[model samples]
Target: MNNPEVYDIKAKLEAIHQDIKRLMEKSNQEYLDIMLANLKNDLINSLTSYVSDDIEHGLHRGMVDPCQMRETCKSRFTEFLENNTSLIGQENVSKNIIDEKRAELDEIRETAPFDKCDICFSEVNSLFEKQLNLISSRQIYSNTEKKQTEISSIPEELMVKSVLEPLSNKQRLQILKSMASETMTFTALSELTGLRGGNLLFHIQKLLESDLILQRHERGDYMITKKGYNLLLMLSNFLKFLEK
Candidate 1:
């Protein structure tokens, strides 16, 4: 491919990239804040049940000892926090926040039969941890959206089969991506792809047949076409989906 082809593809893809940025600027805060509020309230309810056996019947006796019940309740709630089931961040729920929460919960504990139990609620705030390799999903709506995938449906004139078949090979795909910003000489291509002579020519020929790239002659510099660059951009967008 030549310098002109390289510039053409880069210019086109850069424009599309900006448009995608605008489309993905959706406000995720309102939804995230709502979820956070519901989560805290639900957690309070669950903790209340865990600490108290019978809220309606204060005069009734239960078989479970108070000490055992308190330890079990704390461990259960702490494990749930450590698990991160609701995507609540451990950092977001800090030490100070936990202490404040425990103090508040202790006050809530004094209501009715709950006051009879001597269980301290400190562990409720202290056991948050990273769970199941999940990260904070609060910014979920800020990622590449489902609509971005519509670009995959290429028209026949763009030579869909020819273009994608070449890109299917990792080395050929790399060769095209290497030409995104500038044309690459044969020697430079060989070094980047780690393939020399005839072996390198095989992948290069596939891209040429697809017209996804331009070359001066049999062994000249290579540059990506607009079609090729957009394919790279598509793959990049898809990868962003995987990351989310």
Candidate 2:
């Protein structure tokens, strides 16, 4: 394809990817909320059961009448169990519905036309490698200047390898773009990236291992690390150069 046509196709593919991501996120969030509610309900039920057990023990000790407390605890426990059972059933149903929706979304993303631009990939990777080297050298310089000894110093070659490996994967690149603006939960990343939770988790694990990204404190949220941001900036510059 010609340059303009290629750019156009890339834009279209990116747009479709974004749409798939949004739908996936919505479905994932709904599923997560239901699961969390179910868990909370179960916890509450367990707490009530413990309290009831305590009340029963007290009655056996003759601290209170057995009849009234037994009736009250049994009634409350039954009601609690009933409510939780209903909620759990509803959550299961919702999960099935969301799974179907996610499947459809995945189909769309998979079928979207994405021209494999080997040239683009090559250029991006080259720039990424150069930036990685630069960053490594900078870190060494900073450590020497500070004259503060740490337990272990990060190896220069490892730094380059870490960034290079993830940049080689297109899916990981998409994940980086999705996380560029803000931190996202694992489920959100999966939905937006149209990757199954397991697959997304696998890629994320690699990214984290490479130090290209870091998990935030918000439970399951992830954000690009400083090295990641620097690499992204370098990629942006490379793109600009290509445009020129």
Please state every model's RMSD to the true fold in angstroms: 17.0, 30.4
What is the lDDT, from 0 to 100, of the residue 128 in candidate 2? 30
Q: List the residue pairs that clash in candidate 2.
A: 21-192
What's the TM-score of every candidate structure?
0.36, 0.35
Which window of 10 residues has the lowest lDDT sum in candidate 1? 54-63
Error of 1 at 129 (Å): 28
- Whole-model Cα lDDT per candidate? 0.60, 0.60
> Across residues 1-244, which tens digit of lDDT does each residue of candidate 1 receive?
9999999999999999988876665435666788988996776555445333321122122212445455455444444443344333332433354355446555644542554343233223222222221222332222323433554554665555676578778899889888999999988989998999999989988888887898866667788888788878988999999999
The model with the greatest TM-score is 1
Candidate 2: segments with Cα more than 4 A from true spot: 1-160
